[model samples]
Target: MSPIYFSLVTILLSIITITHATTITVVNNCDYTVWAAADPGGGRQLNKGNTWNLNPAPGTKMARIWGRTGCNFDGNGNGNCQTGGCGKLVCNPGNWGTIPKTLFEYTLAQPNNPTDTIDISLIEGFNIPISFSPTSNSGALGGNCRTIRCTADINGQCPQNWRVPGGCKSPCTSQGIGTCGANGDSRFYKQRCPDAYSYPNDDPTSTFSCPSGTNYRLTFCP
Candidate 1:
């Protein structure tokens, strides 16, 4: 190919790369307001029945999203939350707020791998009941993404040591507890929501994936 034609092809490819996007919609299904937070993205105040759509850079990996309850932010989006606060209404890039937080983690599709990996994580702890799942298109495109959720009233059931204002603390975060799969506390979470990560190394059964460009819905209190 000639130099001019090669340059044109390169520009076309770059445009295509930049234009391709994936979306993760955050929905609040609880009866109260939730400060929906995300790393690599940001945070949004989602009222009951409201939603916020996040479009992170393609191939974004090792990122997380969670909810903060009992928040009081100023007009400039600065304040604290009773649970899962990062010191501001909008969290800085790559910031996973302090626990107790019910974390939603994921790795979007990469160039070589057209599948997205995701999981619901209680490693930090649990606040609101949450669910993470791919939209209907996953099955339509031959993707096998499955929904993962922790809908039990963890705060009410948590041990006294792990109790927080708006959430439950994981033994893993509060202290160096036993492996999530073996500990009684972790067992409590697992028995209620078997599909989520009770501890950091809880993979195999916790990690899941979907087709490339698949859309996702993260529902709070689902």
Candidate 2:
């Protein structure tokens, strides 16, 4: 129970937290190919029924996974995408990609709370419908586990101004993020995909979590 020993033990725990890994299986359920990309994980070609597994380092923040539609990467893995492109096939760590695109964002365990925090963010925009959920059924850290989805046909119903080649631009993407509102176009998005973030500030209803060490599945067009 000595002070010095306690400090050493705390440091060890912190190291463990930072070095651990969490698995996320990114699957493309779309009939077409989806270039799956991730900041901190990189990108891969996911054809129909194909999957890409990502193991993000623990204690990582602002980590995200997204699908790039209508991509044309050459054999060298270089090309842009119609939506959610990060300039190349293999995204640099922390690349947010050229958004106006939907996102599966998460932050794994940290010192404060040893649980994974995740959400489906449409704040950037919505290209493809997405579903994110914990693979485990052991319940979340607090409540019963559940899936978060933005599987509404938003592209078919996107407002004229929000319409893009392969995605629907969020109000924040159309207007400046600071001027984004909860009403107006945002409401249209929220009404359909209530569980996903429709605007820049949607943490209260959109964020979800799971126990530490839980794996996840990310599906496009699901």
Candidate 3:
């Protein structure tokens, strides 16, 4: 092959490689405003029935998304939220959402694997109902690439000792415990949301994977 032809082929392949980043769409189905927050994309407030889309770099392996409710932010992006508050409009530079919130977690394309890990976690306790689903056109890689959710109203059913201002506190968290491995507290969450991570050690069936290029749609209050 000619030198110029080889150089052109190399450039084309690089373009394809750089364009393989994943796209995530967050939709708010609640009747109230929800502040959607993510590590890479920062935060945005979504009024009822609104949506926000984000595209993270291909090398971004780990990320978490959640919603902050009852927020009162000013023009300067400083305010307090009832749940999952990050303290700013754009939560960056070491700001992460508060506890007692439903989380949509992700592990994008790794070095040796072409599949992405995705899950809905309730180990932190739940404030709102959330769900994760692949886009209709997304070519799922494994049989486990199905929608996962925690639609229960955990806050309402939370034990009196585990109740918080606007969220439900995990029994372990309420009792100042760590790593509830097969304990009664962990069992409570597992029984409610069997597909979610009830504690740190809850794996196997909690984690799920899809093809690297698959797009995902995450819904709040769904």
lDDT of 3 by residue, 1-222 (tens): 999999999999888775566789999999989999998889999998999998987867678898999899999999889999988877884576788888888988788987788888887778889888888434455568878888887888788877889898876565554645668877777888888988876779799888776788899988
lDDT of 1 by residue, 167-215 (tens): 8888787556354445776788888889888877788788888876778
**Best of the two (1, 3) by lDDT:** 1
Worst 10 residues of 3 by lDDT: 171-180
Candidate 2 lDDT by residue in tens digits, 153-183? 9999998978889888888875888778788
Candidate lDDT scores, in order, read 0.84, 0.85, 0.83
Residue 19 miss distance in model 3 (angstroms): 6.0
* Cα RMSD (angstroms) for every candidate in the order listed: 2.8, 4.1, 2.4
Question: What is the Cα-based TM-score of model 1?
Answer: 0.88
Stretches off by above 4 angstroms in model 2 are 1-20
Candidate 3 clashes: the total is 0
User: TM-score for every candidate vs. truth?
Assistant: 0.88, 0.88, 0.90
Residue 129, candidate 3: Cα error in Å is 0.6
